[model samples]
Target: MTELRIILFLIGVAVLGAIYYFGTRKKVDIEDELDFSEGEEDIVSVRPNDLPRKKSGLTVDEAHQAHEAENVQTQKDKIVTLFLHARDGQQFDWHLIQSAAEQVGLEFGQDNLYYRFKGFGNNKELIFMVANMLKPGIFQPDMRTTGLVLIMTLPGIMPALDMWDTMFPVGERIAEILGGKLTDENHHIFSRQRIASMREEMREFDHKHSIQ
Candidate 1:
């Protein structure tokens, strides 16, 4: 009887050991599966080449060429200017200038300067602008200036020649009224030769624009 009981106890111990080993292996397999699932999720969430980047436009050389072309066009469109200066050791009186500008059909408007317009009312187009030679170039009450600048942009609302025709007479009249002398842009005496040259230039400008 004693031998049989000992054999039965040994059998029970072997069965318990098998159950424990299988349960531990199954738990390790489940944990390994969970770890593998988490790794798969991380890989799926990662995206290659997802960062934003600047879109390519012009190349460096092309951009520089474009800038140079714009500058050239701006130079071509630059204003053509003439100056009117008071006689030596003299300055122009503000009241006289106002009256002279008005007589020449210049109206005080934008930039506190004077402008000569082409038409009447809303249809009016700017022919030229006149400003004080002083810094900031605004005409104010009781202002006295040594000179003035008359300016017009090329290819204006009117043909360049016609614009010059209107502008020159207006400058002449204003100078005559104010006892001033009309000069070139550099404030040098405006010679008859220079006047003829300017007229030719204006004609050339008008012709070029007409073809365009």
Candidate 2:
């Protein structure tokens, strides 16, 4: 009887030990799996939507105005543009256009367009640029265009007002020579009022830059 009791006790202890071992091993394995899952999450890439965005406290119009002001500050000069167009139902003759440009002291050079320079040779300063109103913006022999575009940068080799003064007459001369009409950028007639307004703007620009 004693022997049987001892055997029973030993069997109970063995069963309890087995249960404890398996339970502890299972718990360790579950913890290791959880740690591995966390490590994978750390290496995963974050989605763009999850990233933070900056909140600018400016309204759309205010932001646009600020951007324009910044551009004006950083840009070397302000651009003034004018157009020369043929009469309705008419196109400019390529040969006449070339002659008119040359007559106005414009040289056909860079970008296959014409340029007016302030001085001679390498010391020359570009006053303004001219381009064909058509696509590719180049003057080619035997090619007709409805118009030409003149672009001048203000506060260039001279004061803004002075540059405008120089460029306007050149446009007028080209118009006269080509039988074309001088127009504003909007293709409206270059009226006296518009000229006055543009001169005033140039004056303001010159004053702002402290240029004589």
Highest-lDDT candidate: 2
Candidate 1 residue-wise lDDT, 121-144, digit = tens: 867666677766543355788988
Predicted structure 2, TM vs. truth: 0.63
Tens digit per residue, CA lDDT, model 2, 88-200: 76888889998998788899874466878788975666677776654445578898877777876555678888889988999999999988899876667878899999899
Model 1 misplacement above 4 A: 1-72
Report how far residue 196 has shifted in candidate 1, in Å.
0.9
Clashes of each: 0, 0
Worst 10 residues of 1 by lDDT: 44-53
Pairs clashing within candidate 2: none
TM-score of each: 0.64, 0.63
Q: Any residue pairs clashing in model 1, and if so which?
A: none
